[model samples]
Target: MLLDTPVRLGIQIRPQHVSYEDIRRAVLTLEDLGVDILFNWDHFYPLSGDPEGRHFESWTMLAAWAEQTEKVEFGALVNCNSYRNADLQADMARTVDHISAKGGEGRFIFGTGSGWFERDYDEYGYEFGTPGTRLTALAEALPRIEARWEKLVPVPTRKIPVLIGGKGEQKTLRIVARHADIWHSFVTPEELAHKVSVIDEWAAKDGTDVSNLVVSNELQRRTTEDADALYDAGVRLFTLGFDGPDWDFDVVRRWLQWRDGKN
Candidate 1:
């Protein structure tokens, strides 16, 4: 509906099954391969059905990645808003922003959401508020985080793009329209089209022009035309996830070809 430009590729490096050396190598290779962003999950332990399967703290690893890599933008896929105080989160993000910039400037995209992990809350002594309440908390935390960043001792090197990940029609998309620079949702082409329509309607009602807003979705298949169709529908940021230090580059290279208008 609001289509205009080409799409790019993002890769999520799971820090659980891989060694730091493995992750560092993966990052360098992705940079060489021309992937756009590198993301990590924000859980202390595995969230994929196993409590002790594998995992790492999102922010700390991001700091490491920030210092270790040069070109790719980096952030959590979606940091749980309820995990840390909004102000502290802002400070941490700002620190990473500076770290990534090193000296020139940093490129950190803030991908965040209302947490949905019950184990994290139960084990860590966090409130683990009801889903509705957690969403409400996430809603409240966002503005506060932005305000605190403004009050930080040294402001972020850049405005720091905010990406809201969720598909809750009543709340998430509304939040995206209100606050997000990019809206990351999971869907097929049909689902994406439906959501895009809803997003536009919400944007117009809220008097928000989302022309510059990026449409992001996970990459799960190998078909080029499916990727092309998504791009045609205004989706520009494509992200893929992998499970190990093995760091598969086949899918990444294929997507990069599409991203760069190669074969």
Candidate 2:
């Protein structure tokens, strides 16, 4: 479990039932408000609201955010590994990294996961493989993604930080132990402690030390006391989710105040 990392707050502005202009304004406001990381999700349809309501694609908006914000680190909460080829995903990440970098190493965090939403697959003409199949694909794809990062004409400006989101002990935690710089999940503080121990076991098996791997968890429904418990459990990165039509940031401001106190 991480010990010395600073408290950082991230916001995932779900891109559904809202206009692009509204999202752009929200982005600008979030950066100005000192949000540490800004995230969207990888999905074709609204995760909430009207199922067929208006929604934007993830990567294209992320590209725009790369140019729009200067201070905030940003990426998908978790891009679906099953949506695109591994090499292509790497190239896209490298390109965004270049775009987001302002005379320094870029702020793009390559947060990804094996795809899970079946509707996205069914409508997009991609196979809706079983969880095991998708996890297997993710395990295979990460190496190719890393390889492509090295082979690109203008390689990534920095060793891009990979954030893998999941809590599966058998497959997902093992993958996180092997490849991730950050591991994100929705588990509680107690669960986090147990999961981190499991991840450490996996790290030992992999012959790598993941001591520095940042533990990330959701803060949308949590109180400051709960967040403190998470902090005590070595969770340094806390993310709040904001839904669209009317994106609320009052909670974000409160979390920022909590983070400042912790730091």
Candidate 1 residue lDDT tens string, 90-202: 99999999999977778798999999888888889899878789889888999999998899989999999999899989888888887898899877777887887778888
- Weakest 10 consecutive residues, lDDT, candidate 1? 1-10
- The number of clashing residue pairs in model 1 is 1
Per-residue error for 58 in candidate 2, Å, reads: 0.4
Candidate 2 lDDT at 100 equals 96
- Cα error, residue 12 of model 1, in Å, equals 0.6
RMSD of 2: 0.8
RMSD of each: 2.0, 0.8
Off by over 4 Å in 1: none
**Distance (Å) between predicted and true CA of 122, model 2?**
0.4
Model 2 segments beyond 4 Å from truth? Answer: none
What local distance difference test score does each model get?
0.83, 0.93
Task: Write one digit per residue (lDDT tens) for candidate 2, span 10-104.
Answer: 99999999999989999999999999999999999998769999999999999999999998999999899999999999999999999999899
Error of 1 at 114 (Å): 0.4
lDDT, model 1, position 158: 90
Clashing pairs in 1: 101-105
